[model samples]
Target: MLRGPRRPLWLCLCLCLLLLLLLPGAPGHRGDAGPRNKKAGSGRPWPAFQGLQERLRAAGALSRRYWALFSCRVWPENCEEDEEALAGTLGLKSDLSVRLHGQHLAGELILRTVRGYLELPRPDKALVLSFHGWSGTGKNFVARMLAENLYRDGLRSDCVKVFIATFHFPHPKFVDLYKERLTGQIRETQERCRQTLFIFDEAEKLHPELLEALRPHLGRQAPENYKAQSLRTIFLFLSNLGSNIINEEVLNLLKAGWLREEITLEHLEPRLQAQIVESTDSAFGHSCLVKENLIDFFVPFLPLEYRHVRLCARDAFLSQELLYTEEALDEIAKMMVYVPKEEQLFSSQGCKSISQRINYFLP
Candidate 1:
């Protein structure tokens, strides 16, 4: 009571000021500490409507009904059986056991991922555009496999939707026009969906210029206001083409003084004085590989020779009525052997020994 109270307010203020001056920044403060982590609100920020799935199911049902109606109206004989089969395939019933066997899981994964991204909110800004190769349709069986996976993964066609479009490039005359039209269509799709996951199934079908035009968009980069929207678009060029074709095209461009050499068979195999159509007409030739830049392509899980043997076996089975029993396949596989041409082999020594050779045959 006799002594005056010694307040430490001034000392505390002085200490705070000193600390502020000495410290890099205040705790939890981002001053001069790089970008701030603006945390977005957690939770699925998209519509949780199930109508899309219901609509898809309904559409499937309706299609079945339409088929029944049409069959009954026109040919009435097998309409009931057809309707039942369609219903079973379309999973009309809740407990319908529908099994889809896919040849390639990677392709399925790519397609499913794209579909999932599209199902997210405001998909109009995003898209998954797929490309098909020679004699391939946009609705190829593999593409349908992807679509089926997406559908199974709860991506109802009516929900937060993105367009899955497939484009083809068979002729050169339509290359530029196709690119222009595709670019415009993509932009328009983006404007509507706001997000897109572009998928190119047979990317090799695209003209080099068209591919270059789309290269920037094929990656993970988003345009704007959609940074969080990761566009997992992919370009799967199931071709046998390799970098050699690209090199040849480059050389031709350099020699011709053309600003850009369109990648084609003419540029790649200049020795052959045939049209592009003629060059690609060989049945056994590696057109798929050459056109798709698949040179040096190797399947890590299986040896190249074995893969080729399997492919050959499959092809044989498809073309002819050969029953490929497991034992038979194994036997044929053992007999298959890869014989590298002189020019194709990297080194002469590399092909001297059977063990050293890279085989494309089964044996």
Candidate 2:
């Protein structure tokens, strides 16, 4: 105590000890050590499926479509392989199903035959190409919604002449490569179908070159007196790309007439237009399309509210028919609590968050 220099050293040591004690796992520490150290299998539960029974009753929905996507199916061995062959095709490792955030994130590519030669009285001629974004699957919520809508429009599994080809772009590296592969596939498949609609889920991932290649085909009408072949080809590029790439190589392609001017601008929805204009990033901040050329259809990003969450959760739960048990739901729910609400849902962070918890739960 008498030596000034020695006193400061002793004070510094005490302060460090105080910080150590304050940290988790310190003696008498009380805060949650996070989902990792929670009591085995004791966590927030998934809202019970039975709780939604009344809601379903009021909605007058009782079909498998209401809850089948979430449920895992052990299809006959090679069912996926057969389905791929029947549809345009993609290589997948497992039966397609939506995964809980707590489970390992697995990527899958699927092709569901919307309509074809068998159902149609005459050969149909149309194909729809769909692309999904980061952390988004080819068969996730948005894709399923679009599919259901298409199915309701007299487009049966093998009629309407529209072959739906979906690809999974889980990594940036996969984007250009996927486009190259898809271009070849589309060229081959187009000959079989009369017309084609290329749908890009998150078009931003698509390379400029690919979009350029498809531009010549988008919105082109057949020659006059061509028997009205009903060849209404469409290219639907859905992206959060917006105006951000104002000066990127891809944008230059658009400026240089690589893409059809009208198709590029008219296809982008208004919300995306705003995002492009408002964002500060050079790549996405500016408009992707020139004046008068916008997206054909624009589905805005859904609002963020508890009601939206409840709706999404209900939709997700009902889509899968409550396959997860109460315990499993609890484990997943607990894991989600550690993730920020804004950052949750169809995001890679959700995957990492769950993986961390799973590691903690396992021996």
Candidate 2's residue-wise lDDT over 115-219, tens digit each? 231133333233333322223212243343333333333223221223222345455556577567666665654544444334555455444445544543443
Backbone clashes for every candidate come to 29, 34
The lDDT, on a scale of 0 to 1, for candidate 2 is: 0.34
- Stretches of candidate 1 exceeding 4 Å from the true structure: 1-148, 151-167, 188-205, 219-232, 243-303, 307-324, 330-337, 341-363
Q: Compared with the true structure, what per-residue lDDT tens digits does model 1 show for residues 112-183?
A: 444354344433232333222222111233344333332333223221222222346567777787778767
Residue 210, model 2: lDDT of: 50
> For this target, which candidate reaches the highest TM-score against the unseen true structure?
2
Q: What TM-scores do the predictions have?
A: 0.31, 0.39
